[model samples]
Each structure stands twice: as C-alpha cells, then as structure tokens.
Target: MKRQVIRSTTLVETLAGVDRQSRFQHRRAFTLMETLAALAILGMVVSSLSASLHLYWKYRSVSRSQITIAQLQRGIIEDLTSDLRMTLQDPVAVRAASMVAAARSESATEKAGSEQFLNVTEQVLELPTDLRNQPVHFIGTSQAMALLHEQRNPRFDQARSSYQSAGLSHIVWWVNSEGSIRLPLFHSGPQLITVAVNASKDRRGLVRKARKDSGGSASSTSDEDEWLVAADVTSLRLRYFDGENWRTEWNSFQQQALPLAVEVCVTIEGGPEQETPVVIWLPQASD
Candidate 1:
C-alpha cells in the first residue's frame, strides 16, 4: 500500500508539469492567421510609400523642365524686342546702303580693282526713282525674318573682338535643323541673308545670324555671330501686325514702313505648355 501511494503521486506530478509546459508554448507562439494579417498590412504600407515617392519624382522632373522652358522663352522675347526696337527704318537709305554693301562684297570676293569700288557708288546713285523699292532691307515671313538693325557694340565680347563700331547690321532669325550653318558674307554676295532649313536628324534649334559692317565692307559672320538661340525647337512662327490687321508676311520695301507689332510663337519639346507666344511692340513702327 505504501509503494502504490508513492507511484500515484509521482505520475500526477509528471502530468501536471507536462500540462504547464504546453500552456506556456501556446501563449508564446502566434496564430498562422494573425501572422498572415500582419504581413499583409506591412506590404500595403510599403506599397503606398513607394507609390508616393514615384509621384513626387515624376512631378519634380516635369516642373524642372517647365521652368527651363519658361526661362528660355523669356530670353528669346527680350532679344527680339531689343532688335526690332533698334531697326533702321529709312527705307531709301537702307536700300542704298544694302546695295552698296552687296556690290562691295562681290568686288572683294573677285579681288577686283578700284573700278569695283566706283561701281558701288554709281549703283547707289542709280537707284530707281520709284517710291517703293524693289529689295527692302526689312523682310519678314511666317518662319523667318531679316532686318537691318543697329546693334550696340559690346564693351567686351571675346567672340566679337573685331566689332569696334556699332552700325546698321543685317540680322536674320530663323529655325535650322542642321547642326551648324556658316555663312561667309563675301560668298553670299547680295543675298547676305539666306534662310536654309536642311533636314537633319541630329538636332533642331533657332538660329540668329548677324553681319555687321566693319568699314565699307560687310564683315563675315564668325561662329559667334551664328548663335543657336534655343535648342530642341519644334516649331517657330512669326506674325506681323500692320495696325489694321495681323499678316503672315511683311516687306518694308513694299509697305514702306515697319510693322506696328510682331508676335512670335515658339514650340519646344518637353514642356507643360509646349507652345508659348510672345508679342513685342515695335517703337519705331509708331514713328
């Protein structure tokens, strides 16, 4: 009877210890459903954060592009305004000067003698008496414009070191797809301003060419003179306001006067508003 009691007590103690251990393990470990729910919540939080970051970066890029384009547009408008404001509007005098310059350029190219110089003077005197000149210094089209404007001599321009005096300069503004264009004034002759848009797959941009008079001859435009005003320009349109209405074309020689205003629209790639139009009033036109 003593041995039976001792064996029963030992078996009861062992069973109780096993039950306590099982309960402790159940309390320490998580359920499969709880673990899956926690994991799903974590995934959602991470996905939401990633999407927010992506949107932020996308908006940042677009904003930067738009700012750059706006700045470029402002610069273009300012330059056009300055040039048009200083345009030399004396049609007869401009026509005579242009002719003389043309004759001189041709003579220089041929290495002619004093006879060529005399011919330049004679040609200027022989201009037709008609009030409307045949070839005007100011010519404007939808895509391009050329005019005789007085450009201020830069006090310190490394590119235009030869420009000592500020005089009536033949200015041409146009869009060019070609990588680069070099126009030698001597070779171009009377057609000092040539608007050529070559089909190029490399790049497209707005170009400004200026041929300034040095002494009696028109100096050849250097690389600096042929400036790439704006890059990645898809389209450029120029409209002239003649006080009465807006026209796609204007010839000072035919109209015998400058346009009252000019509207320039430039379209560039990678901008919020791909196209921007700037209107510049010509002060000389009012006079």
Candidate 2:
C-alpha cells in the first residue's frame, strides 16, 4: 500500500510540473494575431523612417545644387560689372575722331592735285556704305557684345618682347553650341578675348578664348588662351538699355552712343530650372 501511494504521488507531481511548464510557455509566447499586428507596426515604422531619410537626402541635394548655382551667378555678375565699368574708350568720341581724321585726309588729298583729288573723290563716293562709315569699337547684339576695356591687372612678360602692352583689351561675349569649353579670365597682354558657350553630350559651359589680334588668325595651344567659366548652363541672353528704353540690339556705329546698362540672363540646368538676370551699369555711358 505504501509503495502504491508513493508511486501515485510521484506521477501527480510530475504531471503538475509539466502543466506549470506548459502554462509558462503559453504566457510567454505571442498569439498568431498579435504577431501579425506587431509585424505590421514594425513595417510601418521602418517605412516611415526610410521615407524621411530619402526626403532629407533629396532636399539636401537640391539645396546644395541651388547654392552652387547661386555662387556661380554671383561670380558672373561681379565679373560683368567690373568689366563694363572699366570701359576705356567712349564710342562717340572715337567715332567723332575717326570722322575728323577722314575729313582732314580728304582735304589734304584735295590740296595735293586736281587729278588726284578727282580720283580720290570718285573712289570715296563709290565705296560701300560699310566702308565709308566709321567702325565703332563697341558693338552689342541680342546674343553678343564686344567692347574695349581697360585691363584690371596688366602683366608684361619679360621673356616675350613681342607681347603688346595690356593697357587696352578687346572683350567679346557671345553664345554658341559647340563642345565642352571653359575659359579663364586672361589679362596676359592686349588680347582680343571672346566668351561663348560650349555644349557637349556630357556637359555644357561657358568658354573663353583669347587671341593676339581681333582677326583671330593666330592660334596657340596655350591653356591660358582657352578655359571654362562655368558649367551646366542651359541658356544665356544679353539685353541692352539705352537712356530712354531697353533694346535687344545695339551698335555704337549706328547709335553713336553706348548703352546705359546691360542685362545678362543665365539659365542653369539641375533640380528646377533656375534663371538669374544680372544688370550692370556702364559708367562710360553715363558720362
């Protein structure tokens, strides 16, 4: 009887222990519905965080691009303003002086002899309107502008005796579609400088070309002659302002005066289309 009672007690204790372990496991483990709910909540949180991070990076990229463009625009404006302000020769005065010189030459030829006078007069009368008219140093159009300006920093090369003095330089700004181009500001000597757009499959930017003469017949492999000003330019437009009104084109030869101001509009590509217009006043014109 005692052995049977002991065996029964042992069996009951073992069963109780098993039941307690099962209850503990059931309490500790999640239900199927609870697991699904927790998984959904976790996914939502992860997605929210991912979206926030993506937005942050996107905004940062756009902001950086905008800042870069803004700095470029500021630089362009400063350069334009400085160049325009330092114009050396007044177109009106230059044209007047040219006219006076021509008149004196004709008078002197007339005094030389009647036969020579007749021949010269006939030649002058038969000359084309373009040739007869005085050429103005300043020429501006909707897309391009050329002017004579004083060099800010003149450099004389001791090694190159042939280099001209940089007291006066000719500057031309235009827009064109070609290859990747960038031109640095060159003040080596009296040079005919041209600024234009260079466009390629990968990049588009402004290019500067400096030549020894206005004819651009001389070519050099020097990197200083050609370089880039800025990149990723979409468009460039130039406008002129007379004393009375704004004009899309200007010719000092025809108008006999310089524009009061010049407006430059540059459009950049990236993020959103950004266009900045900069106006530079001409002190020579005002004078």
Candidate 3:
C-alpha cells in the first residue's frame, strides 16, 4: 500500500456530506423550508375550516329563530280568525260551557291581567297545542287544580252537580319560565274575549301598541283612551272599511265601523323574536 492516509475534512464538508446522504439521496425528502411551509398551509386550512363551521352554526341559529316565530304567528292567527268568524256558535261540549264561565269571570280577568307575558322563545310547560279549531272543552287547563283553588268560575260547581262530570280549563297561549313560548290550546266555544294584538320590538311577529288615534275628530286625538292598546301588544288593529276607507283606531272605527273587508293584523313571538305583521282580509258589511 502506498502511504494510505485518512481523509481530513472541515466541519462544513462533514455537514454537507450528512445533508447529501439524508436529503439529496431521496427525491421526496422535504427541506427545512418546505416543511415549515407545509405546516403553515395546514394551519391555514384548519383555521378556515373552523371559521366556516362557526359561521354555519350562527346562520343555523338565526334560521331556527325565524322558523319558530313563523309558527307562533300562524297559530295565533288561526285561532283568532276562527273565533271571529264562528263566535256566534255555542260550544256543544259540557266542559266548554264551563270554559266560557272561567274565561269571563272577574277572577279570570284578574288572573289574565296579573299574569306577565312570556319572554323567551322556548316553552315553559309541556302543554299540548291544538291545531284543530275545536270548541274548548275544559277551562281548568294544566293548572286546573291550582286555578280551581283560585276559583275564577264555577266549572267545579257545574261538574259537581252533573253526572257527566266534565271539568273546566283556562284558555291561554304563552311562554313559561323555561324560556319557552307555549301556544296553549283552547277549545272554548266561541269568541268570549276581545284582545288587541300588536308587534313590538321585543317580539318580532307582534307589534306592541304605539299610538292611539280618534276618528271622532279630524285631529285624531283621544281623551279617556277606552279604545286603548297595551304594551307587549304584538298587534291589535281593527279594519273598518268606512264604507270608503280602512280604519285602525277604535274611535275612528266606531265612527265608521263597518268594513266590506276587515283586515286583522297580528304577530307571534317565539325564538329570534320575529315580528310578522299579517293583514287578513275578512268579509265585512257591504254597505
């Protein structure tokens, strides 16, 4: 052997050899820069996916809120229209008779007045809502026992004497403490009560009372405000075709209270607080 000697190399040459052996040897090996770039791209993709998911959920919530509001409004409108059109017919059910008594009793009025309106979109109680326009058969409702203890009407009295033994229930559609707006069912025979509905900022489908006007005078003013609208009123407007025009205020309506076509407006609040104002045209006096 002719003077075999070990090769001596600098640190840079050693490192270059290692790099060539590790990366340059393979066609698919990633460089440091390429690895960092891939990581950054992956992060961006993940962030974009997260943002998209959040947006999707937000839109879904808004859509659900709107749907709920629509349902609530539709239900109220159906019940109101049925009562107005078929108020003349009396309920044939024995329990419904008791319902009428409970609906109009002083205690009932007080109870309705005392009770606060529902605020949430969800329902409090699991009360069943009736889709059919059947006559109210009971007046005691879910809180029949509690309401009976309060005794607004003589539903118990009527049932006690009769062998038929039908009972009574309250007729109300509202929300409960659990953030739910319950569309309570009522089978009461006919329109036994008058309600002024409105749409308010709080509830979407309903507009609360804003102003009071009088048709008695050209100025449109009110004094006693007997024809008054209350707060939390989603909508309570009257359509009196003055034989010439549609009037909303009661005073003005009284002045010309006969409409060939009566329009009823209403709103229902459930979720997302939708204020849907519907103008239902009804057959009014031709003259």
Question: Number of the top candidate by TM-score?
Answer: 1
TM-score, structure 3 vs. true: 0.39
Q: What TM-score does each of the candidates earn?
A: 0.67, 0.61, 0.39
User: What's each prediction's clash count?
Assistant: 0, 4, 41
Positional deviation of residue 232's Cα in model 2 after best superposition, in angstroms: 2.2
In angstroms, the error of model 2 at 203 is 9.8
**Candidates, ranked, lDDT:** 1, 2, 3
lDDT of 1 by residue, 1-287 (tens): 99999999999999999999998778667576688899999999999999999999999998888899888888887878777776777656556767677777777878655697787788776645443212245778898787675665232133455543355566777788645433222212223333332323443577666655443243323223445677777677999998889999887755657888999998877754546578889876222
Rank the candidate models, highest TM-score first: 1, 2, 3
In the range 1-287, model 3's lDDT, one tens digit per residue, is: 22333233455678888998877746455566688899999999999999999999999998987776566557656644542332112223223334334444644556564233222112222223542233222121121100101121221123222222122222222222123222212222232222222222343222111112232121222321011112223433344344566554222111212123345444333333434345544333222
Whole-model lDDT values for every prediction? 0.66, 0.57, 0.34
Per-residue error (Å), model 3, residue 102:
43
Q: Show model 3 residue runs off by greater than 4 Å.
A: 4-30, 87-238, 250-258, 267-276, 284-287
* Model 3 superposed RMSD (Cα): 20.8
Q: Point out where model 1 deviates above 4 Å.
A: 1-11, 31-39, 91-135, 153-158, 163-165, 179-204, 212-224, 272-274, 285-287
1-287 per-residue lDDT for model 2 (tens digits): 99999999999999999999998888667576688899999999999999999999999998998899888777767766765665555544554546555666777766655565556556533424433212235667665566655453232122244444354444555444554333322221223233432333433365432323432222232112333456666567889998788898776545546778998987766625646567888875333
